[model samples]
Target: MEIDSKDGIERKLNMAQQSDFNDPVISEHNIYVCHVPVNSAFYRVIFPTSKINPYTNKWLKARFKKAVRMLEMRLPQDADSASFDAKKAKYIASQQQSTSKTSFVMDRLLAYEDIFIGQSHSFDAAFEYAISNIYLCPMMGSFEMRHLQAGLQNLQCDEAIHADTDSEFTESESETDDDPSPLRVRFVRPENEFQKKRREESVTLRNKVAEHSSWISLDLEKSTMKSASAKLNSLFSLPNPVDSLLKLRDAEHLVEETIVGNKLAELNLEDRHSLISFKEVRRLPDALQLKALFIKVGVISMQHIEELISFKIEHNLLISRIREYAHLVRGVWVIKSELAFPEDEYSLQRIVRDFALCLLNANLPVRRSDMQLAFGLTVEDFDFSLTTFGEHITSGERTWRLRIDGDETFGKTKEDLRVLIEEKRYWNRRWEEIHHYLSTIKNKSDFTVQKTFKRSFSY
Candidate 1:
């Protein structure tokens, strides 16, 4: 096979002639880059695969040669095949586990198996792993819990596999179709207590989600016409709005296929990349539509939020400040309305009572940005130094009182946020001031100022 390196191309070289290649092309035009780690005794050579002995035979032995010059060769002349395979295996094992949980795995579990079965087995496993490995592991009390029904189903599958294997090896039974071969073996139901409990839990949970889901649907449809205009602006939009929507609608069906090769190449997920790139990924309809739906889904269910609840929200804007995080709530339902209520949101009972009032006033289908208006906040009117807005969190409750200095323990939340939505009033501002000084820049564009910001979402 011909070879190429970062240095230059080398033609028709056998494995030994080329000692090492930072990059090499092997038999069938596969190309690889080898990296020799700093402060290490050995190095790795990578190359394209060969049809006949693509990655096989003498090609690998050449990889074993320690010296730099000999390592560059395409093939090694004297090495035995067995030794190369063993070393190659050793080398490969040193690599971090790169085997992906395949789309096949997700497909086999979700599509091939029963719906609940996949969620119970693979879905839960992946979810648990993500929580434990990525998030919750350090906490002392954290423990992984399994759904009892899922556990039982898995236990049953294992037993079935064993029974089938044993029946095949049976000496006495000779299968004959005429008499139906004695039909079958006795079935033993799973006896595990956890399994029984999980099964019952699964049925209960399914019913709950189904009931809630139905309620959500009915509510959203009722509100759709009223709120449809605001929601659709974000949903049906196209960079080239006329053509992009049709392309996006087709994308919903190909989620799995579209995400495969293009995942990390995705600029939006990595914040270090320019925000312009973030806008580009949003052009993908699956992500944009999903986000649009999710935001609306919560709007439809706002009544479900209890007045004294605090919801950690999405739509956070990250500016330069080290610890400051900003969240924008598009719409929230107010439980009650009053001509005049307490000026602050600090009191537990008061914030819920007041915020609920605002929700009631917002009418159906509040613009997410409009939710800020429900609070009746102004930077000039409110004192922000003391409480900053924490008192406004309903904690676990939905209604929160924005804290004023009088109830100084709680802080100005919606009040502080008012600065964001108020149309920029400083007439004296320079072009550079808008460009750099506005740390939380969302609503500006050279051609047409982007009126709003959208978060790319995936569930």
Candidate 2:
């Protein structure tokens, strides 16, 4: 048997050094940027293997010098080997307790053990010290929560490191498996009651979201026709014959005559009593008067009629509004009519205001479905078309925000809004004036008809 010599071991060490440069082991020892939230102050570095000893005594000298450098500022150079070994072991053992809950302390300890081995000059001794002295504290949180907290902590560490480079080693500088940051720093906080509750709620919400997002065949089939129909309605449309024949005076007047006669016949004593109970009996003639007036105006579109109904319902005057509705139903069917599509200007403005309120309340860009839910509405229930809404609201990745610039709140205020408000008021006043004129003409017609009937019946 031949005894391994110093020269042989030195040659092997040199060859290993050269081989390491070209080996794939460099990739396995990946440099990871670590963060610990426990301390919220520092990051630690982690090494791969802790084997610093060689087969011969010649390797001992080089190993000792490097060990001295690692522990140089903390320990004296003249410190005895045994004392240095004890201190190094204690340091690493203390570090293990500081690691994140999901982080493997043993792997990190093994990497640091190599440096400690240089001081102890014994692989077995350092390995034994590491295993016996390093303590891994029990984690009190769920594994995923621990991991998520650790990841957030790491990001904070990364940001802190960038702001100040005093702990530059913590940031990843190489592609090696060795963690570039300090592994001894505590990156995570212990779970408290508040945090536990929050995590539980978060988990529950996530599960609910997952369930909601799942594709159920029934739901898909149910929505399929509705979505198709909506698309079809938007893509194709037919003009109402009522709108086209509004220019023919005799045809339109005949239709109005039939509506008024039917409404007068439907107004039974019981219906009139019900209207009186609601304090709306007085508005019955106004409804008839408005309908006759609208027929004569010719320019008053069917959408304007629908708006009148909506306006009456909104003001709790539905009993009065239904009189006008009665006439509209007859005219639409007799003329084979569909109401013309209304301009979205006012409706779109209202919807956009709702979106702005949503953002203000949430303080973040919310999903469209979430906004709709807040309003107790389905996605399809928005007053304006989605295509029109898209023009005003700023859309994000699956989210939407209000374009608040030059608005009264949420962004810079400007004079343009006031001008817009004035324009709206001006149009409203003009519309009121036209309605008043129509009402005056209808009152005169009713008086003339009553007087002519009285004269014809004189005996």
Candidate 3:
């Protein structure tokens, strides 16, 4: 095996030379072994020999010798030897068994295993011993909470006495109170001198921040100063004449423009007219005035007029004049002329047809009852209107929808329509069979036919 040092130096060592070095009692040197290649004779070692103590140098040399010996022993003379293969398999099995055993022990320790220390009888004593052992070494600094918890649970307190007396506890009390107290496990260790000094410095910084916050609050309440300028003044406590001149020059454009651009594209003519009228009035009319206007119009309800007055007062805008000409009747708004029917029957029928068509155009599949109420038509008049618009509309089970081409598909594709038609044909064939059965059994009572029909329906 070859050893490479940090000072760009390399040295080769044979088995005899490697075995010559003695093991050291105390070593501080860091050594690393490179990965071994499959079926290789020798391995590589990377070690830094420069500035290393005599003990570390001796320790590294001993480690290298041991590694070389292990590699040489594991190396087989022949590649296809059955004995070597068996040895390799045995070694692998032994390693796996060791790993599984270590894991099992770790799981047991993490659960509730008995941990005993020399002359220690209580969990607290055992835990303290473990903690002291960890910190006793100068090299060890801290331990984790999980490790502490597992250790505490695994601690054996078989010889523990009651806290109130020196007498040994009974078996039941020992069993019930054997578990360690989680309250005793602290995440943070006690602060040392250095940490105490840092904490004091942090307190001073916190006080300064609090003082600055108070100053900021006082400044906000008492001063009308601009934020950027106030911050700059607070930081520097001086103003530059050249910077002031530049700021004044920039402030010249800060004045708002007097002549606003036209917004004709955004506002329609009717809206523009309303805006102009509102601008001329500059105020909303009184509620009594609005109520009188609504009464004269004879359309809006008293509550609706109050709502409109409130809206106008909030927005300070005039209501549109288009709706003033219409009158509300049965929750629907209609023109004044539409309230009266024509004296001639033909003209009245035409009006009803036109009204029904308008309703159908707005919302498809208008119900017949809704049409009658909306058009103020009797059954005869509604039938006549339907005849008039027969070509344009079709009747459903209880509603009327406009007759559009391909509407039988009901917004479905050709494939979906085909499936629907097949289902319809199946039902139609069953109905035909029922009809033929009924015809053949005409000599029987009507009750028999009804019973057969009900049975077929159930089937």
lDDT of 1: 0.30
TM-score of 3: 0.14
Q: lDDT tens digits, residues 1-459, model 1?
A: 555554465656555556685555443432333222222222122333322242443222112111111222222222233322322222223342435466864422222111010011111111112222322111112112211122122222245544654433233123322244355645497458997799899989866654454111111222246565554343322244455566564544355344433443553421212233222333445334222222222121222322212222332231111012112222322111111122344333333333332332232221223334433444322223112232343345443342221122211466334532331222113223433523333323422342232322321
Candidate 1 vs candidate 2, TM-score winner: 1
1-459: candidate 3 lDDT, tens digit per residue:
455554547866554445565554342322232222222222222222323222222111121112112110111122233322332233333333433344654433322211111111112211112322311111111211111112222334333222332222233234445554667635477878998899899989865654453111111111344864554244323335577576563432332221122331243322212232221122233523442333233233323444444244421132223233333222222233222222354565645554444444345455667766544568776775554223323434566543322223221555434444553454355446545644554546566989999999999
Q: After TM-score superposition, what is the CA distance of residue 304 in candidate 3 from its true location, in Å?
A: 50
lDDT of each: 0.30, 0.34, 0.36
| Candidate 2 local lDDT, residue 291 | 35
- Give candidate 3 misplaced runs (Cα > 4 Å): 1-343, 391-397, 403-459
Top TM-score model: 1
Write the residue-wise lDDT of candidate 2 on 144-217 in tens digits: 10001121222323454445533323332232223556667453887789988998999898666544542221
